[model samples]
Target: MAVRMLINGVAADQVPALDRGLAYGDGLFESIRLVDAVAPLWSRHMRRLVESCGRLRIPPPDTMQLWSEVLEVTRDMPHSVVRITVTRGIGERGYALPAAPQPMRVVAAFAPPQVADSAYAQGVRMRVCDIRLAEQPLLAGMKHLNRLEQVLARAEWSDPAIAEGVLCDSHGRVISATMANLFAVVDGMLLTPALDRCGVAGVARAEVLAACPQTQVGALTLDALLGASEVFLSSSVRGILPVRSLDKQDYPVGGTTRQLQQHWRDLGLRWSRADE
Candidate 1:
């Protein structure tokens, strides 16, 4: 089967054109990886989604109802990706807010992408994107609807060999990968970029931080990243993917990266070849 979708608890494939999310990108979403028919980091995803809703002033959906809808759509699927979207329902002609706004809830499930076993066992190659992320403090760290930056950065490459792309902010500070969070092992210290200026704070990134409490979150420059002994990317869908090379720079799969992969398995979110 292909992708199954539901809109506002109904079996539908599309939303009305006037929906605020369609008109103005006014909404929040969470992409969760379901393994063995369960979402391992569901609570973390929910927390972020609720926080983002609060930030955007979009009334949060009922947690229980949302989960039920997710389960309903993903039922019988052993491995899949479930995306939950909450949008401000159909609105008036302008940017003005509706006095009694109704929120739309969408739950969809798709077959997970088939990643080669080698891509996980032996690190994957990446590239440095020419496009840079804009610094927006107001929208930083939240997975909001506007994603033109990521769309453009991802369009920079179409080569199948490059597993991901490293994206930096306007000031040359490394923020994250096109679809994941960035992390590096520098001189025995674990470091990840601070998302205050920009970037989505991924759920897998939070798991890494929790596993390694000593992780330093701060500004990470391109020089700092290239100089690191090990580099890895994390996302809710693909857990920890060590970077074998970025552009012409080479990186080893190293002990630190493997250890972190183990940490992910310990958290009961196992899908990587490293777990095998």
Candidate 2:
């Protein structure tokens, strides 16, 4: 490995031109946070990767081999982010699957995002995106390579003040942020948007639900979100981040959000202070 990246167990920076991931977006990816070169949620990520591969009809990579590759790429790095990408490999010019399929795996490591301490302490600002998510039950909840919806939603805002963008389904139900899962405390009960119809069911969201047993998953309206006493966004890389405001509606950084942040820290994941 070239200290940062590996392509199919080789030290390379590019994949074949006919790769299906680039040609048709036939792949899945996972972004894992590394603390002291260790991934605390490795098993959770691998479980999702295997399940998604089964759904996409692509052969899953061996978990042990992938972990070795992850270690090789992130060696000596105190804190970083590693992305694992698995694609259908090179294929012909059409949509048919290759008779003998060859899956491509790419593991790369880089410095973690520089999120300020205040983003976790004081909370971050968010905006409601105009782009609505289309419901697709078959493809829901997997971090597949095709992400044009999130691309358009994130493009709606370029202001440095906005930390994230909220995405809703066509029926006006809040689904998630452009890059994270949504959570709101409504009437003293923890609620998250149900992903049965659409939206990605993130690993961090699962962890939150596990730690906070009172959480309820169902349809969440934009009005309910604005009226909630607390709101937060969860991501594998960013961990748990409280939403201080959405558009003009403001929310306080409540106790539930603080408790979850401690839970994230206890798991050896740090988004705001990577050095510590």
Instruction: List TM-scores for all candidates, in order.
Output: 0.97, 0.97
lDDT of 1 by residue, 63-92 (tens): 899888888888898788998989988889
Q: Report the C-alpha lDDT of model 2 over 204-275, residue by residue, as the tens digit.
A: 888888898889999999999999999998999998999999999999999999999888889988777542
How large an RMSD does model 2 have?
Answer: 1.7
Give per-residue lDDT, candidate 2, residue 15. 87
State, as a TM-score between 0 and 1, how close model 1 is to the true structure. Answer: 0.97
Q: Rate the local accuracy (lDDT) of all candidates.
A: 0.89, 0.92
- Those runs of model 2 whose alpha carbons end farther than 4 Å from true positions after fitting are 1-3
Write down the worst ten-residue block by lDDT for model 1.
Answer: 267-276
